[model samples]
Target: MRKMHVWDENNLIDISEVDRNKVINPMLVFSIKRDGTKKCRLVARGDQQDLSTYSKDRQQDTINNMALMTVLAVALDHNLIIKQLDISSAYLYADLKEEIYIRAPPHIKQKDKVLRLNKSLYGLKQSGANWQKTIKDYLKGKCELEEMRFWPCVFTKGKFLEIIVCLFVDDIVIAGNNVNTINQFITDLQNRFDTRIVNDGSPNERDAVRYDILGIDVEYKKGVSMKFGMLESLTKKLPLLGVEFKKESRYNIVPGTPNRSLNQDLDIPCDKDYNAKVNWIQRAIGLSNYVAMKYRFDIAYYTNILAQHQLYPSDAVLFETERLLQYLWTTRGKRLVWKRNEKETSELIGLTDASHAKGLKYKSQAGYFCIWNGKKLFARSTRTSYVCESSTQSETYAASECLAISRSINYLLSTLTGKKPDQILLTDNTALINSIKGTKTINLDPDIMI
Candidate 1:
């Protein structure tokens, strides 16, 4: 805080001068990194402040997972150098909009005085928005980068330099064909804000770029493929969740069995230990959902099922959760590999499927995956909002949802690249395909058509 001059120490005043409600208590948070490094941050109890005082546009946008993956595929196709960076004290660089007061920290030796903030601080409701605006202005104005219309967190430099920069809060991933241009951009960023490269080794010594972002480990192969996985993270978390491996001859080939009915209603145990069990089940489901979303699409369906029962999970649900974790542990080496596909033409390819009336409430389960350059860009497994009367109707509903998401992905691709690529959606249901081809008539809800 002293280095950034986050606040003026001389401006401290008595509490009577400021509204007591506006004054927030300061908090210090500390954590240990994987490398055994300790870090601390001073934050404010922003929750105590009046909600009406916050700006309606305080929520900041980050690059979506689909767009991030698409960019990585493009980078792999072009053999672009991928590097990562972290902005030191990122939120502290932004100027605070609202008038806020904080009680002095214990080490400051001024217990009676309240300090006025000049810049954004951690834990503030609008801190993210303020930091986003700060970085966006610097990139657009100082760095001369153009922000993508569809993805505000993505920026590119055209004409002379072919570079792309993606922002996920404080972390930055830069991809470009020109090494000198990328280095120069990094230099400019460092000059503007205190920053450090997140790449594992020194640039000269680094053979292949490797780093972790958003809990996903990313590695760039020279001309092969970009590999993404969560093995290391999952390995560390499994023991904490009580997932154990025993000497067994056989292991689960799949995350869950298709024949097993995960949606069956089971009585929740009324024992005193039920709450603790429920919490453990929820935690396991949460971790599984993260892994499924980022790296493993195979577990997506089962993880979604476990998530639905998180509120009141039965012993059977807990057992299912453990099985999913065991499957993950058994196949921890599996990763999503984005290989360079020479014949890949389209920017986005979609495949969708539906399970008719699979849930206890008679709701259909819909799942869809979007692909780029023959690699999976993103996938989603969700239950439909309304129950469908037939399998065809459920399939049609799933297709509609997939089409909506594909349009957004298409728009993002078009904005990034000058030309929009053709989209092809595959479905197994013949009736739905025939309806689209005008060969057969199938009654679909007007809302679904829209």
Candidate 2:
């Protein structure tokens, strides 16, 4: 009744099958479209009080952005066509394993009769997970596709006419060399589940603007590149967090001041709206963090520092966040260009740095970024657990941390492409570099080894 046809009279059960103990509360979800439209959908999410008691696990995993980007990189290398697909009413295909009851739709004549759902509906906590599992099973059993060992959401099938599927919730992107094979796969999917092919043409020239997916605009001009910063989602999201700006307002050149750290000594003003401000700050950080990870590697270090003070944000933290937004506004059109490398090497290169004992707790804060095939593959910054006795120890810890992350990434890349490449790690600290290459071994704390 809420614009979603999730329920039908044929699917409704008699009074005998109804479980009185299992009562579910349903709500309407109004989702905003990419085209600035809105749609109301019915969700059969049960009572919030009983969430803890729900037996079904709601944790669902999608394809990691790094893995997804690698897949796209390979597609771009082969000059393969990128196509997006949406499963029409994805949740409806998933059958519920547990007995659940939802209130009848408003138009139903029998007010006393509660609808016992045979299939999963939107708004259920476990709906997304259920749908994911169902599709995984179907793809493997019926479609003859094998999921990758490292990234289970990525599916591969066939040899020369292979089709690779990268899944993010209900959104799917399929890439392959053979057009006929890809069309057949889509046709098969359409026969089983309702499918809506989206972003069908060249992403670069479509809609007179670049194509966007997961808040990142993908352009397929000379090569496949992804852009973010100036997305409409960011524009709408920032204002909702009480951030306002004038049309002619100039933004800061940099997101953060050079070598700036959070001022722990600064006190937060005890205003009546302090809690509201904190919530807004947290939401802003969370939203910005996604873009930073997905596309803007330059801002990862800046975002990481801001995130550290999320629990107890001060006026100084708020000011820094505003500055970050200003920087994003100024560099709105920046993109990560993933050009075609003639060598086609999959080697992983790493660069690492550490601010020795610079954190509020006197712990070292480290940052590392990895590049693959001339594109920034991953970037991460974090606070270290161990305190260093000297600068060398801090640099060692940072280098080791960076190496650990590189190993995991290498494993994924190897599993995906059946090739292992040496990790070329780069660091400014000469002592740390020598230590990794067996030139030196500085005495470090035993506890820090872990």
Candidate 3:
């Protein structure tokens, strides 16, 4: 292990970073590779994910949502954001191929301590791998899966009908521009897995989690949560479990979670000097939740940094995340707005931020945002953006990063959003901006990278 101190370190970099194509998911890769032989090598490998890991004095989800509300506000108006909310079962364990072993839970019932593997558990190592396999297989060639720093895991077919699907364990959130396409996608999905149809008209009203996040009540459930029925009835062409994605909304998922130790500390960041840093963290968290809403993949860097302080962020950290959350709450009613124009075009906008000498570690923070349909998202990823150096050095290095991401987004602008390669970026450093645009004479040497 490396000796790294968070407070005394001289190098601080944004912690979110990821390789979009690799899909580090073990569940998807650990499938039965049938090549005329029986069971081939297990393609997936990773430790199990524990939701309990999120249980702590700090509420990362709440923080992130608060940030998301802001972006959603500016991008969308009083209407337009909608979803097909539905829940078939509480949660189902995923089926697996390998026999990876595991010890029993600390306090749960122990039928047998070291049990074998037949399916995935809340904390199984290959659980995500299996889920990824299923999702990728379902999406294979329809959408574009970006592997670069700009956008990852985005599926598109030249914008005829765009769909953004985010798979989070058992909860799947799919946002699409068209209702016909979304319903068709759901029907096809139900054919593949044991999915409970959502938004069908045969049942009593709406599904739960429609206008709510965890327990915080959302404002626009009709358009955002209850819009699933439009797709359900429209896609009646393909029949699944007796009806289209059924139209039943439930609002009873807020009493308690499997774990209830949350909200112990709102833990507001109370310092005055870190206001800028606080704002940066807020934007990062908001962008992260936005990434979950849209299928954009460039936000891994910022969200990861905000996540580090999930347990107990200082006044410098918590306020930043809170700022972002306020943003999300405002925008929660919005969706990735896409309209078909006679010009046959779309545009992609991006933003990047880097701070030096600001962190307790004296490290720099780097964050970037990718906009699809003017709907913003900081990609959800396992990586974070972090670099150690002086403020000047950190800003310059972050500028280069900003340029790299801009170039990648420029490529996707034509491919995904249908607009020209022109992008707008916002940053606090004028020197970095000038350096990136090549309009100012700034030192950009590799040896001097922070």
Candidate 4:
């Protein structure tokens, strides 16, 4: 805090002078790094701020998962050099737009005084927006990089867009075909902000092929393939789920079992112990969903099902959640691999399906998988919003949803790679196919019409 001059300690004012409502509490967040280094950050309780005092649109945008996956695929396809960097105390660099006072930390001797913030602090509502604008201006104005229209957090440079920089708040991934060019940009970025290149303990940081970005372990094999996994994250979460393994314990072959009946016992009295168990189940489902969304597509359906019962999970649901965690522990090493297809075609392939009336309340389950040049770009398994009368209607609804998502991804790939890929939406329903080909007319809701 002293180094950054986050607040004016010398200018501390009496607490009675400022509005008591503006005074916020200070928070200290502590964490350990992978390299065994401990770090602490001082933040403000932004939630306590008066809603009328600040704007509601303070949330900042970052690179979405689909865009991140597409960038990875592009890096692998072009054999680009990928490097990661992080800006230390990123939010502290941005100046505060509004006057906000925070109570002094415990270490300070001034118990009756408050510190006026000179800059943005962590946990502030506008801190993320401020930091985002700061970096966006630096990248666009200073670095002369053009921000991609589809993804604002992504920037490109060069005549043919040789360099691509993806920003996830403080963490940055720079990919380019030229090593010296990327390094030069890194140097420029470091000079402007306090930056550190993410080093994976490699002999040369510039030539690092393994990286941990956004909690996903990414390993690149030049032009061969790229693999993404969450082994360390999942391993850490397993113990939190109260899962233990015996030496001779057998593992589950699948994350969940189909056609399993759930205990619909909502009449059970809600006690403290029951509420605790419900919270535990919710946390477990949250972790499982995170893993499934990031790289574990196989468990998406299971996690989706488990999430529905979070409000009032029974012993059966709890058991299934634990079983899923055990399955994850057994297959922790599994990774989502993206291999370079031998073919030089730029195509976006989509596969979508739905099971009618499979979920509770007779709701259908819809899923879709999108592929780009043999890489699994995106996948989603979600329960349908409304119940459908027939399997054909459910399948059609799923295909429509899939088409919308696939087209958006197709746009991202085309803009990044400079090639318009043909999109093929595949479905097992012949009636839907015939409807698309004008051979048959299948009645669909106006909103689901293709």
Clash pairs detected, candidate 2: none
- Measured on C-alpha atoms, candidate 3 has an lDDT of 0.40
TM-score, per-candidate, Cα-based: 0.91, 0.87, 0.43, 0.93
Cα lDDT of candidate 1 equals: 0.80
**Candidate 4 per-residue lDDT over residues 1-450, each given as its tens digit:** 888889877887999999887788998999998657899988899889876545788779899888888888888888777888999999999988787899988888788899998888998888899999999999988888888886769888874447889999999988877666677788889888999988522423544377888989988877788889988877776787777754344546788767785636645556768888887888888888888888789999889888877776677887888888888888888999988766778778788999998787888989999888888888899889999999988998888788888877877777777887878877899778777766436533222223
Clashing pairs in 4: none
- For residues 1-450, write the lDDT of model 2, one tens digit per residue: 323444556565555566556657667789878777788887776545254435564678899887777776766665666788888788888877766777776667666667766677877777878899888888888777888876768888886326788888888888777787788888888888878888764543342225566667776643444333445666666666665653454445567877876856446667787788778778878977887888888888888888878756676788888878777765656777777766756667778888888876788888888776676777888888878877878777777777766676777666555676556777788777566555436532222222
The lDDT values for all models are: 0.80, 0.72, 0.40, 0.81
Candidate topping TM-score: 4
| Lowest lDDT block of 10, candidate 4 | 441-450
Ranking the candidates on lDDT from highest down gives 4, 1, 2, 3
lDDT of 2: 0.72
TM-score of 4: 0.93
Model 2, residue 406: C-alpha shift (Å): 2.8
> Runs in model 2 with CA error above 4 Å?
1-20, 47-53, 56-58, 201-210, 222-230, 246-251, 266-271, 439-450
Residues 164-208, candidate 1: write the lDDT tens digits. 899999989887777777888899998999899887223334456
The most accurate candidate by lDDT is 4
- Please give the RMSD to the true structure for each candidate, in Å: 3.3, 4.3, 17.9, 3.1
**What shift in Å separates residue 161 of candidate 3 from its native position after superposition?**
2.7
